[model samples]
Target: MNYRKATEKDLTAIVKMMADDVLGKKKEKFQSPLPIEYVKAFQNINEDKNQELIVLENEKLEVIGTLQISYIQYISYLGGMRAQIENVFIRADQRGLGIGKKVFKWAINRAKEKNAHLVQLTSNKERPRSIKFYENLGFKATHEGMKLHF
Candidate 1:
């Protein structure tokens, strides 16, 4: 898999893959042609120094996976920086091809580059497979995750 920082041109493929999955199907909106708000969001992320939107391409140059890594500083962590991994998605056909491992390894390496004190992510409790996958990657679920959705 070829990994690269995403460009605005990648939004369509990113949104498509994001919505192609079960959970995303309910929450993500892909443009029948592309949306203005999505474009704005892409630009915002691109401009943010603390965020990176990554895309993974196959040999054929198709976008097969994507994720966002955000580096933030928290006083609770001794004012050290932490990296949060989010929106990880691999094309349905690309699952179990060792691509996920590569993607996550890439993210972790990136966190290290940023000198982050911690790297963390949250998987929906409904996805047992993802939990097991993360566990296999050496991530421990030591704390409960909570969220307040609007």
Candidate 2:
């Protein structure tokens, strides 16, 4: 398998992966359907210089996974830059084989390359496995994260 930055042609496959990740026949609270416009917004990541979308592909260049990072410079952290990992998804059958870790490491390295002081992510409470995966990768849950449906 190969991991590389995503391009326009990879959108359809990436969206499918994301949809599966979000609504995979699981009755999780986080399993809400995503609007088509939300998927279209991912195109902005490809166009933005400070943000990026990556796709994981096989030898045949078929997209099977995706990861994205958004950079934020903050004053509260002594003017440090932060990179937030978002929308990370792997093809369902491809889980548990270290591909997620591989992509995560790649994202970390990329953030470090960009001089980011922190790399952050949030896993839904329903995804205990994913939470453990992030913990194994050195992420800690230090603060309560809340969302309001409006």
Q: Over 4 Å off in model 1, which ranges?
A: none
How many residue pairs in model 1 have overlapping backbones? 0
- Per-model TM values vs. the true structure: 0.94, 0.85
Worst 10 residues of 2 by lDDT: 23-32
The clash numbers for all candidates, in the given order, read 0, 0
Model 2, runs deviating above 4 Å: 22-39
Give candidate 1's whole-model lDDT.
0.92
Candidate 2: lDDT over CA atoms? 0.81
